[model samples]
Target chain A: MINKATEVFVSRGYDGTSMDTVARELGITKSAIYHHVKSKEELLHLAINRGISALDSAVEDERQRTGLTALERLRAAVHASVVILIEYHHSVTLLLRVRGNSDVEREALEQRRKIDDKIRALVAEAIGEGGLRSDFTPGLITRLLFGMVNSITEWYRPSYPVDPEAIADAVTSMAFNGLEA
Target chain B: MINKATEVFVSRGYDGTSMDTVARELGITKSAIYHHVKSKEELLHLAINRGISALDSAVEDERQRTGLTALERLRAAVHASVVILIEYHHSVTLLLRVRGNSDVEREALEQRRKIDDKIRALVAEAIGEGGLRSDFTPGLITRLLFGMVNSITEWYRPSYPVDPEAIADAVTSMAFNGLEA
Candidate 1:
């Protein structure tokens, strides 16, 4: 049901979507939806949480927690983020489009910031150990790295032949080695 | 007036904004706004075009046009894009958030795609001249590069101490040299 709600929210703007629309799309009564979810806001919260939990788990994955080094863990996190984003494309798309008009959205934004802080910490650790460049601030590096990865949500289509692993590889290569020949 | 509208759109969202709100914010009569723009859609068009024109001018700047290798031009475009995005942060924020729900929005999206294609061509040319890595497709590279650059619209604030030149330098360095120590 939350998946269905996510699809509606992704296709229709969050403000434009309603419980009635979700119910109509699901071929269920509004009362049925209300029985499970109290409001459209609740549904949106659940939908966004799907993407957030995926990202949080990716950063806290066993590999990231016990990696070869900070750089390795950072790379793993980046790769995992791209993969998870692709895996939960619809929900993440909805999450990314959020503009914090409501308390639920504010909470989601806060959660996203926590994830960003974790990635930034990994970047700082990598720079500390001389695994990554230290000239740019870790905060800037984190934003750019995630910016590149997060862009997948804007243009990626399931119809495309590209897969998550391929994207992860490209992001890792371009971010670490750059485009210089 | 378009700038004011852009500000309102950036804060309240395009759909949530109305000419009445813009007029209220600007301390102008609705008739005065109607004298210039036919409707809210027209205002949105003008606002988005402001950002689009800046980007187009950056790509067509004399520096981008003459006496540079493909790599140099690509770097120049990257730098100019970041600068322009910061310079026109509000309008570009609205432009980036547009989902093409209206005719004006569709036109804006089409213009954005034209700029994207131009950048992609630069990436291809750079690869042809051995200035960039060819392992990743030009399309992928362009998306990632702009994704990183375009993200400025989401977080950049004029109150922040960061300057456009510094951002441009960081983007060029990280994009060309990458993060490897």
Candidate 2:
């Protein structure tokens, strides 16, 4: 029921949606919703928590793996993120649209920043090991990396049946190699 | 008055904003706004026109300039886009938020595609001249280039003293160099 509520909230935004709309979408009474959750904010919290937890778990799993270089580990983490995002499209979309406008949004933003910091550290290690280019600032590279990955949400459609791994590989290849013919 | 209208439109979005709200923000009657534009849609058109024209004119101007390499011309065209976007923040913000849900938005999307085509041609030429790396796909590079540029509208703050030229340089540098040690 909260998952249905999250889909409605993400598609319509927070202020534009109401408890009545969520209940209607779920084909349930408002009282029934109250039986499960106290308010819409609780639903928002649950949605963001699910999305963030999935991502955190993915990165943690990748970090636990051994024998991979920092570059490889970072790529694995990015691939895990893409997979998680594809699996939880609705919830992740809500996480992305968060504007730090509410307590839930602010917490999401902070968690996102922590993930970015972790990714940036991986990029730094690759640079230190001479596996990546050293001329660009890490800060700028971090922004570009996130910009490209985050942008996939804007265009990715699951109905197309394309492999998510293929998409991740393409991005990794393009980032590592320049377009010259 | 139109500036105030644009501000409201950018802040609240086209669908969420109402004529009365714009009027209230301006401390004027709704009838007064109708004297300037037939409807809110007309205001949206007027606001987006400047940004689209600026982009089109910049690319056209760069195309006409001779004695420059394809890479140089491409840089000039993109730099012009950043500069124009800075000067016309409100309009570009509206342009970014456009969902291609209306005729006006559809037209803007088409024009944006044209701009992308022009830039992609330059990138292709640069690749032929060995100015860029050849291992990556041109299509992916084009998307990343423009995506990073477009992402600027999401975060660029006019309150800062940074020059748009510096931003263009930073973006170009980040695009060409990977973060390696």
Candidate 3:
């Protein structure tokens, strides 16, 4: 149901989508949707949470990884992030498209910032531990790294027949090792 | 007038903005704007064209650079792109935001594609010359490379006290040599 709702919301702008539209997409009654969620906003909240929690949990899991260097943990975290992004394609799209227009949107944006903060801290830690190059600021590296990763959504369609792990390897390779031959 | 229109378009969205709002933003009469352009779509065309031409010219100039390897030309093109993106901030934003809803927008997107094609060709040439790694496909590398470059708009505000050259250097450094210590 949430998947159908996300598809509807993505095809139609959030403001343009309605419960009836989503219900029609699902070939179900509006009351049936209402039985599961109170409103369209709730559907949005749930759909985005599906992505946010995956990312949040993945980063937390990487943090718990034992015997890894700070740099290794950071690489693992971003790999996990790209995997989550590919796995939760529509949900991540919704997350990226969000603007803080409503209370719900603002809260989602805040949670996103916390995730960004987490990654930024890890970048700094890696730099401090002599694992990452210090010439670039952690903030800048984190910005560009995620910028490249999040951009996968713009082109890496699920039907492209490429593995998520392969893309993740490319990202880490281009990032940690540079693009030089 | 084009700058004001671009600003309005970026903030209010293309569909939501109008001549009246742009004129109001510029503190001018609607007739004054009418003297400059025939319609809102013209304003959009002119505004995005400002960016498109700058980028197209930059890439072309880099292509013409003498005594440079394909890898060097590619690096120069990306550097010039980041500079143009920073210099023509609103125009690039408008160009990026376009979804080809109208003829003007479709034309803009087509021009943008031409630029992408040029860069992709350069990537392939660089790989053929053994300057860049052949591990990633040219298409994938171009997608992620431009994605990283384009995302600078999201965070690298003009108010930030950093030189465009500094950012360009950082980009080249990260792309060529990576973030390793």
Candidate 4:
């Protein structure tokens, strides 16, 4: 039920979604929803937490892997991120849509920043190790690489047959080699 | 007055904005706004078109610059895009928020695709000329490049001391080198 409500909230946006609409989608009373979560904000928070945990888990997994070069580890991290994002499309969509206006939204934003910092650290390590090319500033490279990765959320639909690994491969390759001949 | 309304619309979102609120901020009659535009949608259309025209004009200018390599032209296109996006931040904010629900939105989306095609062609030409790396798929690389370029819209503020040209140079360099050491 929370998942269904999350889809509605993602499509309608938080400000556009309402308790009554969530109830309508679930064919349950508003009181029934209240039984589970305190309010729509709570649902948004729950959904964001689920998505954040998936990303954090992916990063943690990559960190635990041994004997990999920095570039190899970064590739694994990208793969895991793409898979997790595709797997939890609805919840992650809500997470991406959030603007830090309310308390819950601000908390989610802070959590996201921490997660971003972890990912950025991984990229920074690779840069420091000379596994990637030099000349580009680390901060700019991090943002561009993540921006490329994050753009998957805008166009990817789970129903599409494109494998998550394939998407990650294409993204990783593009990040390394630009479109010049 | 329109600037005040744009600030509210950008911050609060289009659906969340109301004419009465705009009037309240300006201390004017709601009827006064109707004299300027027929409806909120008209105002939205106007705002988005302003940004769209700027992008369109930039692309045209780059296309017209003779004797430059495709790579050089692409660099100019990117620089102009960031500057124009910063100049019309509120309009671009609204433009990015569009979800493609209406006819105007659909048209805007088509125009966006057209701009994308123009950039992709330049990327393709650069690739063919051996100016860009060719290890990645052209389609994916084009999207990633644009993703990194367009993501600037999310964080750039005109009030920030950072020059858009500096950002453009950073993005162009980072897109080529990546974050690996």
List TM-score per model, in order. 0.94, 0.79, 0.98, 0.84
Candidate that scores best on DockQ: 3
Higher TM-score: candidate 3 or 4? Answer: 3
Per residue, candidate 3 scores C-alpha lDDT tens digits across B54-88 of 99999999987899998999999999999999999
**Which segments of model 1 are wrong by more than 4 Å?**
A62-64, B62-64
Q: A15-57, model 3: which lDDT tens digit per residue?
A: 8888888899899999999999988888999988899999999
**How high is the lDDT of residue A171 in model 1?**
89
- Name the TM-score of candidate 2: 0.79
Residue-wise C-alpha lDDT for candidate 1, range A40-146, written one tens digit per residue: 89989999999899989988882357638998998888888999999899999988887788999999989998999899988999999999988889988888888
Q: Give a tens-digit lDDT track for model 2, residues A1-181.
A: 7677778887778778888998899999999989988888888989778888999889777866799888778778877887777677778878888889888789999998888788888888878877877765566566666666666666666773456776666566555553322
Superposed model 2: Cα runs more than 4 Å off: A1-6, A23-35, A60-75, A123-137, B1-4, B20-35, B63-76, B117-141, B159-162
After TM-score superposition, the amount by which residue A177's alpha carbon in candidate 2 deviates from its true location, in angstroms, is 3.1
Clashing residue pairs, candidate 4?
Answer: A126-B181, A127-B181, A130-B181, A131-B181, A132-B180, A132-B181, A180-B127, A180-B132, A181-B127
Worst ten in a row by lDDT for model 3 chain B: B154-163
Interface CA RMSD, all predictions: 0.8, 3.1, 0.8, 2.9
State each candidate's chain A TM-score. Answer: 0.95, 0.91, 0.97, 0.92
Candidate 3: CAPRI quality band: high
Candidate 3: pairs in clash: none
Cα error, residue A8 of model 2, in Å, equals: 3.4
Model 2 chain A weakest 10-residue run by lDDT? A172-181
lDDT of 4 at A125: 76
